[model samples]
Target: MAETNLQVLLRRRPKGAPVPEDFEIVETPVPVPAEGEVLVRHQYLSLDPYMRGRMSEAKSYAKPVALGSVMEGRTAGVVVASKAPGFAPGDSVAGGFGWQRFSCVTPAGLIKVDPQEAPLSANLGVLGMPGLTAWVGLEDIGQPKAGETVVVSAASGAVGQVVGQIAKIRGCKVIGIAGGPEKCRFVEEELGFDACIDHRGDLNAQLDKACPEGIDVYWENVGGPVQAAVFPRLRDFARMVMCGVIAQYNVVEGADSFGGPPGPYLGAVVRKRLRIQGFIVSDHGWPRYPQFRREMLGWMADGRMSWREDVVEGLRNAPEAFIGLLQGRNFGKLVVKID
Candidate 1:
């Protein structure tokens, strides 16, 4: 058993972009699980964009983290001890164990996985939330049809890559919008997106050239100028599934006072009869998880799907890696490997 547990605690709410100073890594004696609980030795931690919202006091679908609490995150780990039914020592599982090296928690919300079937870390990425987020949003909201044009923002990232591939599986023409030439190439060549546009350049011009048919289904991720560009080109009855808005997640607290004219935007929505739906993956995920898991495992095993990881070594590096994730510096699903 591990002697000490290291946790990354949120020192304070962030102002703009988070600095390493905003968090304090503290070491404590690993806890012993009581009844109905399991002790987890964390192996990998998943860092995602939605974590930014948890750092604020702003009202959201869930409560914000209190100052001085462990920073929240999903983790894949092995059960080192268990008082919980159906779980035992050596069981590989994943849970919202926060950003910690070890945790003692109930097995009620944890999931068991077979590391032999897929890399254990995949339980934190493609076979987990990121992949599920893509599947849920695309199938439920996008409801794409064959030959229809589907565009996804942040298309080289975890969820975006899956969104484009699934759209292609359903016979849709998939266009990916990524930050640079390298990511764009990966999206098109490796992931097989029909086209990938560099979001950093003349976005409107590039999107026009890449998606001449106009966007029929947009799995929206980064929503700022990209959404503005996509808005005008949305075909009638198009659907916009709002999965994330990473672009605005770091606008210094209390400095987010700007809303331009809504008339034109609203007018287009009415005229085009566009359907826009904002969702958090958890709600749709649990009920549909069995299907997602069965299908994802097959896709991965058959080599029809692949994913990338930008792994930062050590739990101590999580704070820096996470800040970089918000800045779009990490190339793929960002994870911290803890020994």
Candidate 2:
């Protein structure tokens, strides 16, 4: 076992988009578990868009990362030492281990992951938080019905990919809005979305042509021009599941800068009788987790669901990979493999 632990600390809060200099990497002694705590040696760390929001001082659903502290993240790893009951060394687990190579956590803070069910990295993606977020947003909020037209922005991303696939299985005609042609093609052919619009093109026109019947369920992920394009097309009584607004995440300016103002859409919201609700997946709590895990695993086993990952090797490359994620450069779920 290594004598030291490598950790990424939030050296500086980002002003707009994050830069490499905003983070600092340092080494320290490996943490020793206390009573009822287990020491974890992380193998893979999940990089997500939500982390950007946490890096800022702005008030959000979650607290901001304190400067000079370890950057927050979810990780999948093996237990190296344990003082907790029912947890033993060599067991695979997933928890909020942050941007570090090792962590000490309690049983409540971590859950065992079965490699036989799926790859260990999957615990941080499709079968994990992102996947659960997709399910809850669509099923609970969107309430998509068979033959309904469902549209998801950022469709090739971690959460968006799962949303689209699940919508398809629910018998909805899924249309995806992605960045490039390659991602659009993958959404259409590989993930089996009904149609995909490349946002770089004429978005309004493409969306109109693809969703001729008007959208019944709109999963909001990117919330700038994409939100503008989709909002006007929602059918009467349409359900809009507000997930994340990655397009506006790095906007240093106020919310008004992103898609102009929400004033223009408020009238339509009332006129269309739209059901728009924003949610933080964690609010749903543990009661629904088993259902999510069971259903997702079954989908994987039946070959109805699939996912992709963009992996960056070494903990040191996390900042670079994360920058790419915010820029829409990553092709799929971005993860860092600790070296």
* Top candidate when judged by lDDT against the true structure: 2
Ten consecutive residues with minimal summed lDDT in candidate 1?
Answer: 252-261
Candidate 1 per-residue lDDT, tens place, 1-339, comes to 658999999998888888999999999999999999999999999999889999998878988888999999999999999999999999999989899999999977899999898988888889889999999998889999999999999988989988988898899999999999999999988999988988889999998898887989988898888888988999999999999989889987656533577789889999999999998999998789889999989988888788888888999999999999887898988899987
Q: What's the lDDT for candidate 2?
A: 0.92
Q: What digit string (tens of lDDT, one per residue) describes model 2 on residues 146-258?
A: 89999999999999999999999999999999999999999999999999999999998998899988999999998988988899999999999999889888889465566
Q: Give the Cα lDDT of each candidate.
A: 0.90, 0.92
- Cα-based TM-score, every candidate: 0.97, 0.97
* Candidate 1, residue 98: lDDT: 97
lDDT for residue 138 in candidate 2, whole number 0-100: 82
Off by over 4 Å in 1: none
